[model samples]
Target: MSNTPSLTANLRSDLPAALVVFFVALPLCLGIALASGAPAFSGLIAGIIGGIVVGALSGSQIGVSGPAAGLAAIVLTAIGSLGFENFLVAVVLGGLIQVGFGLLRAGVIGYYFPSSVIKGMLTGIGLIIILKQIPHFLGYDADYEGDQSFWQVDGENTFTEIINALGNPSVGATTVGFIALGILLLWSNVLSNKGKIFTLIQGPLVAVAAGILYYVLTQGNPTWGVAPEHLVRVPVPKSFDDFLGQFTFPNFGAITNPTIWVTAFTIALVASLETLLCVEATDKLDPAQRVTPTNRELIAQGSGNILSGLIGGLPITQVIVRSSANIQSGGKTKMAAIIHGVFLLLSVIAVPTLLNKIPLAVLAAVLLIVGYKLANPATVSAIYRSGWKQFGPYIVTVLAIVFTDLLTGIALGLVVAIIIILYKSYQNSHFLHRVDSDDAAGRHHVQMQLAEEVTFFNKAAILRELDGLPEGAILELDVRKTRYLDYDIVEILENFATKARDRGIDIEIIAVGKRVMNPPSYMKFFDLAPAVEGH
Candidate 1:
């Protein structure tokens, strides 16, 4: 773990980064809610809780939690199966389950994910972001902003949606998106190096401000003006009382339902897995390479989900997009995430109308830059150079994610990674060499050294080597360096001793640097017979 900057000391950097994340999260919160078929305000509530509560408790400095697009389908189904109020009960129970998972140290499950898969996940998400944002950038708001699934709820797949956007591009939105992109590129490549002014005020904030100004100046011009439908849609309340009325309480009476329990477990498992994965990815993205305590992250996310459910918000999980945005924007502490939540809370109550005035295209442009940074060609090239064993899983994860969904893609990637591991294990179980090729009497002398740990997976390789030994051969089986010898492998050696007798082959078993001629038995030497019999 690396030290995180104190909130007071990191404020200057965190503040600007927070603003950038706020712009990116605002629409995502609403869009995920929309896609989930939940109340629009629920997403906002989740964003606030995820930022304020989870940020405070999480060990992560850069991870940002909110309503994730990955859970949209689950939420939609859960809400439809159980009524909205009953679903809230499930969310609360799910939070409790997540907290239990943290206490049980289930977070260690995250460590099993291969590094190639994690890298693939980041790159896959980057590609998804770019593909999903294209339509929004072209002013075609047919699909929700944060939808990451290849087949969208809007009756079109990722590619089809992009095709549609190309056919019907909005002039005003397109112009503004390109302008925002240009400004972002300029600020990043040129202006930011000029002085402290560019550093203090983020490019995203500037692009948003310019976008609002453009929208205002061209509202009446049909050709150049962005439509109202293409703007951020925050649920605005008519009065302070109405604002407070927005919060919906869960149906405590429905807690006894078995369906609710099932939903709760599903949400808890999925949310915990997503949070753990994001923790790994965020740690990798951190310039300081700080390791976040995974169990603590689970508890933090669980707490956030609890509060979110109580207040009619969606389930919370650490999201990579916002986390990456925080890192790329130079955030040095969790305060950046917390403050972004505060911005969300204050914005809905104070100036939602103003937020609604900003074009979605501008935010789309911001995400475009973030996506490019995540899925850059350099990252792919580096992974490819690591060798096919690594690159296979990395590319598989990327393609699966782009073609399917997040969890499914990760599952497939893990399968590929496991197969690769087995393949490597089979090939590297032992080292065989011909010692002093053919002794004085022309007898073949072969030495086979066992690996540090030899399991049943290595049985085939060892078997092949033993069967290839010629008649009248002198064989030395070395176990001096081996720490673990599986019963299956020992059995193979025991069975081979019988054949060695018929073939006129001499067998020498070396253990602890001592050679035993015609050893009494391999089963007794390795002491694995009883363990295997017990099983």
Candidate 2:
């Protein structure tokens, strides 16, 4: 399939998807901003830059970018340790490093990510979203927004928080969360399927609208009145100047701060890794199976973070939550992603007050649906059915990510994948079979056929096979299918050939390049034993 696209070709599909993404992204942006311990407007700024700048420059058709929940902990720590103004300088510096990474062709690293690990990453994030949102759904509001790490900013872990939330649940928030969840389920299954009118009217939008209406109606009631802390808290600017004043500028003087530079480098490395992983996952999720240019994606992300930092925004990355929503909503091109950004800009500029009126529990319900789709039981079972080669890494990645950070989880999964590859290589380096030709020489023919590739790892296996060869045997060492043979393996075969002659073994080398020999002079050159010497 062609990688390029016409803007208008997917307009119908893209437009509806963009609306859905906007509705999904709005709360996340505000929530992530609140989580980062930064001004609320900063999250919106990042959302805008990610959508408009990255969405425009990126080669990914459906992947969406925004201030990510994954980066919330890092941002929070960075701001607290480096000071908010200095952290802004770090974000800008991190963006510059990402750009350099793109130029260095580091994007090629994305291709090496294992597919099972990618799926596990998606599944792991989904499980984390679900786990992290439970307290919010119950309106506990103890931990700040966008806190997904197992060890929360609060002293409690995820399970402990859930237990605590159950002990002290809010009646109003629970009611809103349940009602919103119902509306989301209904819209996804019934009304949204009825016709075009309902398709464009997304489930989350309706859920948010319903929650806001409920909040207003129940304001004075004793049983259902929602607490102020449980509600969303967007900065309600009094005028245009007040809105502009909310934007914080980076302090260029922080350039000399070594901690800022270290934080910047850390952010750049982690952000780049997350972006590459998401890009890989999103491409897999795409129905058309289009490949994204990983290098261009880094450039887009770099540009977005640079602009976002200048305007006092949180760090941005390619977010799977919004991207998966776009795909599920039938987005066919990058236009949907860009249009969602446009909505984020217009919403803050035009209706920040109305947006602020929405309840956090409602957004939690929407995210719960996304989480369920990602970590469905069927997906887990299917991966298991693929066998341990896939399931081991898949489960390990999920567990690691759920327990640790995204990069660590992926790294563990990759290590497992590499181990499996090495094990398989060691297991299947060659095939040894015995055949007898009747009425010929009345001799047994033992054929050793080489595998497609051989490396130093296969030396022991080949040596064992050679040592097991029977005396006076008619042996055939075949290398016809071998594409790669390590020097150690060649030396083993050459040394074995010398011993075979003494043992009265008829060894016929087949398809091996050049006569393999243990040259005494060559061995002396490296101060090693000659290949022809007996062990």
Candidate 3:
């Protein structure tokens, strides 16, 4: 798929989308860093690398890469075991491993997944976004902002956090959140169409500005004051040198430790999987329906992670949240992603203090819209209409993601989909047509045509049909359409031929080479064909 968006063709569309993605990505960078128990500046570094480096290299038009919430737990544990400095070594090694994965073309694994599971993943992540954002929206900011797992980094599960937030809502934050949500809704559904200025000046930026205004105005009103914790918390550097000092380099001296290698491999595996999955989902979400080069994406992510670790940053992945936000915000090119990275860098250097004043609730409002679009009820209804065969894996994936985590949920959904495939294979091994007319020899004709693939799964079904045949019947078994015939199935057919002879039933085999009447050995009939050149 063509992902090369000409600079002139997409500037107008990409600019506003880039701004929206910047606003969305800023807090997530900080939150995911906090959740990972790393320096807050690390997340920003990763975001910068993911956006500029990965965005420039990736074939994806809308996919946004950054520090992912799904890897927070692993980062936290690794930091505890290896210490922060040494852990950076693992991160760098992981990046190299990812680069190796890309070179090896392991990205093809993404295509093996069923469509039901992919849809389920998208819907599940959408629900997760909405569910995880509630507390932040209500001003209960105990948990980190980008926490997507059911069990949060703050020791609270998804539902329990909402329950707690309901009992302790911040009037100031709630008010700002509602107003921002209103602006977003109005901008998307009404104002954007009425004028180009509204489109250029995206609703998210307006909402954030409004949120900052509210925070400044209500600082002293006890009942309405937005607390420090309820706002964006970017680290403010006092001077140029202080800003430079925030970057922490890896302790490469510890690279020889076996534990470091193991950790590196773990990060590489999980991060690659997450990146591939996001590539598939982001491709599906793109308006142009352009397909991303998965192998190139892995290389891009690896390069980003390596750069991020060299200076101080969390591991990188193609994050669905920011990607979905970019898509929903009208981002049409990789330019949007590249520009968002530039915004992140400029924000850190130029206006961090101003950013810190914006309320988290406003960002939550932006995400709520993104979440709703991804998990639209219309999508669910349409999938349901496709029948249980399609809906089962989709719903399972959705629920599992809600209750567990993204990777685990997809694994479970795949298991269900595979089981369904096997069951269908068992039921559809062959087609049968029996003519009721009796010949002069008092025999009925039965024709059985095999399916494309007759594996061991079909043995039982084929055997049952053969055993039920009448004594005075002429059976014509057709294998011309079969691409693969398992040894188990072939043996079943050979045994059935012997039983047919005893029952006074005539057997005819219609195979690739020729038709045979009551062949002494079915294996010999298959063996007579020339072997494939390669095998």
lDDT of 2 by residue, 1-535 (tens): 9557787898888988888788778868887888788878898889888898899999999999999877888898899998888999999999999998998888988999889999999899889889988898998988876666777777888889999999998999999999999998898888987998877677777888899999999987767977878887767889989988989999999799999999888888888988999999999989999999999888889888888899898899999989998998889999999999998888888887887777789888988888888898999999999999999999999999888767788889999999998888888999999875632656667889888778888887888888887777778767667666666776776687688878877766555343323233322322232222221
lDDT of each: 0.93, 0.84, 0.91
Candidate 1 regions exceeding 4 Å error are 528-535
Candidate 3 ranges beyond 4 A from true positions: 1-3, 529-535
TM-score of each candidate? 0.97, 0.90, 0.96
TM-score winner, 2 or 3: 3
Residue 501 CA displacement from its true place in model 3, Å: 3.2
The alpha-carbon deviation from the true structure for residue 121 of candidate 1, after best TM-score superposition, in angstroms, is 0.7
Question: In candidate 3, where is summed lDDT lowest over 10 consecutive residues?
Answer: 526-535
Candidates by TM-score, descending order: 1, 3, 2
lDDT for 153 in candidate 2 is 74
User: Cα-based RMSD of the predictions, in order?
Assistant: 2.0, 4.1, 1.9
Summarize candidate 3's per-residue lDDT along 36-71 as a digit string, tens digits: 999999999999999999999998888999999989
Give candidate 1's error at residue 9 in angstroms: 0.7
Query: Which pairs clash in model 2?
Result: none
Higher-TM-score candidate among 1 and 3? Answer: 1
Q: Rank the candidates by lDDT, best first.
A: 1, 3, 2
Give the top-scoring candidate (lDDT).
Answer: 1
